[model samples]
Target: CRIQRGPYRCHEKTAGFNFNYTDDPNYGPFLVSVNGVAGNNTELTFWELLVQTGGNGTIIRPDVGIGCYIPEPNDRIILKFTEFVSGSHSVSGNSSNPGNLTAGNTSRLDSIELVVVNNISNTTNKTYSTDIAFRGVLIGAMRRLQTNSGFNFTYTDDPNYGPFLVSVNGVAGNNTEKTFWELLVQTGGNGTTIRPDVGIGCYIPKQNDRIILNFTKFTTNSASGSCTNPGVLLFLVGLFFCFLI
Candidate 1:
């Protein structure tokens, strides 16, 4: 609602943008067009909702839409006009609505376990339950843990890669030592583990997901080590940005 309301409040006072929207009773407000460019289904085009995080120019497409998204201070909202291939799904105008975000098949569990592990020193190892919103981003849950569970963390926002986990608690990663925190997750009935391609800013934690922050290093020429190849890591990160756009 702020996206729709802010312009009217400040249009006469400062430099701003204009937008058009429709108020759906069930989903609230949804963006129809921005700055006069509209999306047409016949043309396979739609308005894509994205945000550039405050202080950094790293852009990310949120899981929620205008109705539920609360922009933080200094956040630059982006309404990109995009076209998608037929038979392929995209995060279009309708897909970002509240109905698609919180409708049927959404997970029931609202809490996830976060395990912090220091593989190098093995000194600091603890777990906390991060209470999360339905389909909320991981960073929100992490902030909640820092506020309520005595957890502390810091990240470096990469212009190209979004937020990179720099440290957890008081432990910081060193570039010279080639050590950094790796994100992993365990899900499903048999506890299948996986390393998420996207970083904290874009990754949404699932119900009962066991998130593991393993402090480790990239091995030199080792095929079996975690994050064995830096090139592969970059490739995955590229895929993440491509999918979001």
Candidate 2:
């Protein structure tokens, strides 16, 4: 069997493995199974498409599905079996500023850096920066980026979780796809990064902080408490009490 051009074509022509996909009106074909294994939403498991770059041997997830992904000659294709957590909302990070700029001076404004990373896309990360008021929310800087730097993003305000980032730079996370923008930060540009327990509306950024907005899928084990977000917990508790009543 001769390997074909696209990923799905390659699978179709190859004899060793089997594959399956559902045709989506907007997104085209969505791969749901491979090698007799199927993705189960109830079990939170899915097949993640990945590629290893030829020369550098770096692994990356392609943003597009099998139908659209044209593999390079030397690219190593990998289909990974994985699980995901529910709920795309939530932002978290922490960083400090040692610079003298502060709101109290009224003359100097603090600025922080924003880096947009798309793990699923084979494109370069985009970097932008914006000035923030003293202890300003992340959304303000994001808005400034849109205004001055041409960077765009859209978010939904969760009544319980505040601002839930819905989309960034025209790429929106889909519930069926189980992908979202995760917020992370490097403190004082010292290289240490952390995911804050708070969302965008609650987390305050310090001067010179490097905020990383990573667009990626969620893959976590069930024992890790992935559904521990405050909003989800509250909803669960409310449902429990309603059942009791």
Candidate 3:
């Protein structure tokens, strides 16, 4: 027959005896197992039983997780993980130089050079040293009026013109005066002196003309004016006005 009882502890020597068969104390023995393994009865206190069941193992504090152990600023960490695992992680912290974390785009050119070639005949060859940003490029002639003669002048884009202010070479009637004359000088027109009768005349000063072509205001990439202070053209104009009077 089966018997039921409240919690009870038996001494080690009598642990295997069936309490239900107390009347016939020696009638049968009880089977005992620890973690699903058959075992002979042995003496054990409650504390010992608890230890055998993993109660003494280290316990992780709830507040401290994997991230808590990371070192402070300037400490380097080498991380090796597969792409899938790495994708799950994120970084957050205050940096010494916060701007280093921001992403920006910048571009730089390889090499830049500015070249201005004057094709006029009378002016001397000149090469101006300038920064990369100021290089002006235009495929045309530079036209201006001679300060001395008040005659329209044409500065060629060819080597003959050299690099100088556009102006007439000399006085109009002088035999030696070779004026750098142009038929019609107008602003914003094709750099050409198109007088059909003169057949594109470029003033050639003869020897007798005492007047000289003066460079007043000269510039590229923008129109010439007092505000810009094209000193070369101003000089030319000053020389022409002085000679004309």
Candidate 4:
């Protein structure tokens, strides 16, 4: 079922590759010539015929005797064959169109010898093989409803979020803001804030700060439930408190 290893080089004058068929009682030995060959009296099974022709020798069908080496476009190649199976012996097109080599198996020919003329083009550059590596970047954020009725959030400062700058509720803040370094010192609050570690950190909008909710400047954090009705209500209330400043 496989072709023999190595390429079968053939010249234009070379006739079809010859094969011997063995006699079998069940199907009876038959003389079968592929491409254009004179019929002979030989009895052999279909499997045996293929095995003798180096069919199982290689990965490709070596019985075809090398496919026409098409070097260029617009080239003509012909394939013929003869099957000797008593009166029932026959031949048919293997592909879509007859006489068209590019059209796959045409002439209903079981096998054919290949001959390459000057139809295909030659390559000057030597082909080599190599492996390639690829890298990608991804950024993400999460918003969740705090068990205490507030919102909890986390985000990275990676470029995947676009430039390093981040504006929360309209106030500019860097990654250090999430660390709550100043808040911890001033308010004696624990350093429990989820600090932005990648690029810039999150900022809680202060009183008098301008803010927008659209994704353009601020995106809803699903982990913080920022887009939820309760989250939105909290944000609005915080904004109202800011205006009092």
Candidate achieving the largest TM-score: 1
TM-score head-to-head 2 vs 4, winner: 2
Over 4 Å off, model 1 = 1-33, 36-100, 103-109, 220-245
Estimate the overall C-alpha local distance difference test score of candidate 2.
Answer: 0.56
Candidate 3 per-residue C-alpha lDDT over 95-189 given as tens digits, one digit per residue, 9 for 90 to 100: 11111111111121112111222234335523222111111111111221123222343332211111222333331211122222222222123
Better of 1 and 3 by lDDT: 1
User: Considering summed lDDT, which 10 consecutive residues are worst modelled in model 1?
Assistant: 1-10
Q: Candidate 4's error at 85, in angstroms?
A: 9.7
Query: Taking the candidates one at a time, how many backbone clashes does each contain?
Result: 0, 3, 37, 34
Better of 1 and 3 by TM-score: 1
> Across residues 170-235, which tens digit of lDDT does each residue of candidate 1 receive?
887675676767777888456999876455655677778988888887543321212212333344
Pick by lDDT: 2 or 4, better one = 2
RMSD of each: 12.0, 21.3, 43.6, 32.8
Candidate 4, poorest ten consecutive residues by summed lDDT: 132-141
lDDT tens digits, residue span 1-245, model 2: 23432233452345567877664322234567888888776675666667798879998765444544546668887777766432321111111011111213433458889998897986689999788755455676677678877699987643222356778889876655656677788988577897754445444677888988887665442111111122332333432110000
TM-scores for candidates 1 onward, in order: 0.54, 0.48, 0.12, 0.13
lDDT, residue 44, model 2: 55
Each candidate: what lDDT? Answer: 0.58, 0.56, 0.20, 0.21
